[model samples]
Target: MGESDATIVSMILAGDPRGLNRFLSRYGHMLAEYIRALTGDDNDLFSAVYEDVLVDILKQLRVLAGTHETPEIKKLSGKGELLRPIFESAARTVRRRFPDLLKASEEPKASPLPVDDLAAFANSIDHVDFKTLLEGLAGPERELLVLRYRLGFDYAEISNIIREARVQLEERLVNARHHFRARLFASQQKAMV
Candidate 1:
């Protein structure tokens, strides 16, 4: 956690209104990206989910800050422990309300690239190819990548949020990366024709 994060957490704990604003400013983009990745750019769903997440986070601020105790909140430390719980809570709420959004894994089809190509493609990824390839990924893979890279979450934190074992999460992430790289390689190959 940085000094700004500590200060924001402290302000929220102290019941300052500006704290919520600051918190929203800090995390709003990440939250937006998370919701979009999950819901596939459905603006209506995104807006509703965003509002719901904000409200939920605000309601639980005191508990998360450790001013009030709950089983979930009890595990939090005072420094910067509030963010994960808040994000996880919002994710769960969104998932519950939009179960259909989680069906990304049901898509049929596999990458054409063989296993040997994965490492090379991953190493050669450039920004343009990365975005194009990322969009081609299944929803779960995209979500996993976004959470790990964009959100700066470790495997442990991701496991906690996604409710999977750390080892399983790591395996899934590895596979997702392979799938993304393979897709990028295939696209590039096609463009050369």
Candidate 2:
């Protein structure tokens, strides 16, 4: 979007390792947050899954380059196998690394904020909401919501990630919004005390 982003994308496409590092440093937190919420509240799980996701990204960079694509590229829907195994493996790793933390670090049950606290509302929520709410929606819907809102992806970007048409992705986003709104409202109500 900006000069630095464009430069970083160029470098990555050009096969410069530094570009990857710079990109990670710039966007890693957002990606981490998205992964954390997506994997529920298991921080260790998030870390492990993130490792796998990073590996996939690096592996795909070559494919991206061969196609002359940049970092800002999106994907179509139903493009690859679901990444559930990544999270499951991460969960297993967490179980091995700190067995005690498993029970204590159970995914949070609701969005972590008061409705009136705009700052807190912005800063407090994580992937847990979508992860927890996923049970209420289909797989595609969950991914759509996370990519579009939690990960700051636009329809086109999400289309890139999901490999779906932008219009279909847009519909998914709308449905995700409706579902998430209901879930978020319920969470807010429950948080009230």
Model 1 clash count equals: 0
**C-alpha local distance difference test of each model:** 0.71, 0.53
| Candidate 2 per-residue C-alpha lDDT over 1-193 given as tens digits, one digit per residue, 9 for 90 to 100 | 2235445555777778887787677666655765554455666766776786666655554554454353333332221222232233333443344343323222223343445765544444552354566545543455556656665666665565545688876875776677666676565455443
Q: Which stretches of candidate 2 lie over 4 Å from their true place?
A: 1-20, 64-142, 191-193
TM-score quality measure for candidate 1? 0.73
**lDDT per residue, candidate 1, 7-80, as tens digits?**
67567767787776778777878888887776665689778888888777777665455653345444444545
Clashes of 2: 13
TM-score of each: 0.73, 0.50
Q: What would you estimate as the lDDT of candidate 2?
A: 0.53
Which structure among the candidates has the greatest lDDT? 1
